[model samples]
Target: MAVPYVKGIMPVMDQRVYVHALLDQFEARYSGAGGQFRYDGQAWFGSDYNKLWLKSEGTVGTDGRFGDGDHEILYDRSISRYFDVQSGVRLDIDHGPTRAWGAIGLQGLVLYFFDAEATFYFSDRGVAGRLTGSYDIFITNRLILQPQAELNFYSNSDPARGVGRGLSDIDTGLRLRYEWHRKIAPYIGITYSNMFDKSMFFRENNGKNNSGVNFTFGIRSWF
Candidate 1:
């Protein structure tokens, strides 16, 4: 006997669209010098194999000025069970003159289910890149601990933006939270940030330590 197959009930996707957004970091950071706010998040919409992604992350500096860290619009294609290829454009709209770049990157899970991303950028200012990774360790069904880190580099320095050549800065932190619900969790953590070389000043004479340990409290959510 042959079992009947229902096309509509099959697992294969046809022409449906899906949307998801995550506010992975929306918190305030306090250090000895001052307090500031930061956010990092991304959203996507598409079918299982193709999608469009939007991302934006930045911080409000101690001087109460805004720093536009990364703003991107990308086209994403699923390549494997846990990876995607992305090509897009990025904009830096800090207090200085705005700059744009051509961007490409790879994002996925690797080596024991770590979330990782590597992206490269090209523009008249030469080239730049970023690498980031985060991992979650489960302590219970609902309690989880996450450690995250990010590195940024540039080939040419842009004085207007206080960006230096070579390796520029590093941000790393750890947070622990309980899943109040499947889509919402509040967490508290600590993050250390350091800036290097000529970029520290944002201009030359205004540079401070450019390094500090900050306390962070934020919420992580998706829907």
Candidate 2:
């Protein structure tokens, strides 16, 4: 999986600028490889805020195994500094299981234990959705800690061709990253995904949620 990024407003400007690019690969008996590139801009409109962004990423293997790339457009509004409402569309372009979808996210970054997102999609395969939540604590200026999890849910499948995993998956991970001057950072982390037990989708598609660890090393910066 690629590094995920979110942008709102910064303390310095009435409106701020941020851009990031990330790459990650997991190699093992089961390998999943992917990366993400994004550009975001946000500004304040009186009290309500507005943002627009574009991102592209993909994943393969099992955890870092074989997978495809996904791209998306995000537009959102922030009711306040700590709370926000967002809506975005995602599409699979390369090695597609091509689909288009929307989502919403909530974050309390200043506080701990509370970042979440829910997504619903109309895919070429079927209708599906996922819910993910995470908690984070900044241990120091150079170190930030994150614990996260995800659940995938699917509805309707092609039973005859044996297509689609009508199951939900659970993933848990501990991530740590170091930031250098708020512009560039290198990080490494690990995760375990349990894809088999929760839903028919995982069981049927043979999308087993074998636990795997991820290692990521890359540069993150903006101008």
lDDT of 2 by residue, 138-168 (tens): 8996887767677766676533322246655
Give me candidate 2's TM-score against the actual structure: 0.59
* Candidate 1 Cα misplacement greater than 4 A, ranges: 1-11, 207-210
Candidate with top lDDT is: 1
Task: For candidate 1, write residues 111-141 as lDDT tens digits.
Answer: 9999999999999889999999999999999
Residue 154 lDDT in candidate 2:
66
lDDT of candidate model 2 versus the reference: 0.51
The per-model lDDT (C-alpha) reads: 0.88, 0.51
**Candidate 1 lowest-lDDT run of ten:** 202-211
TM-score of each: 0.91, 0.59
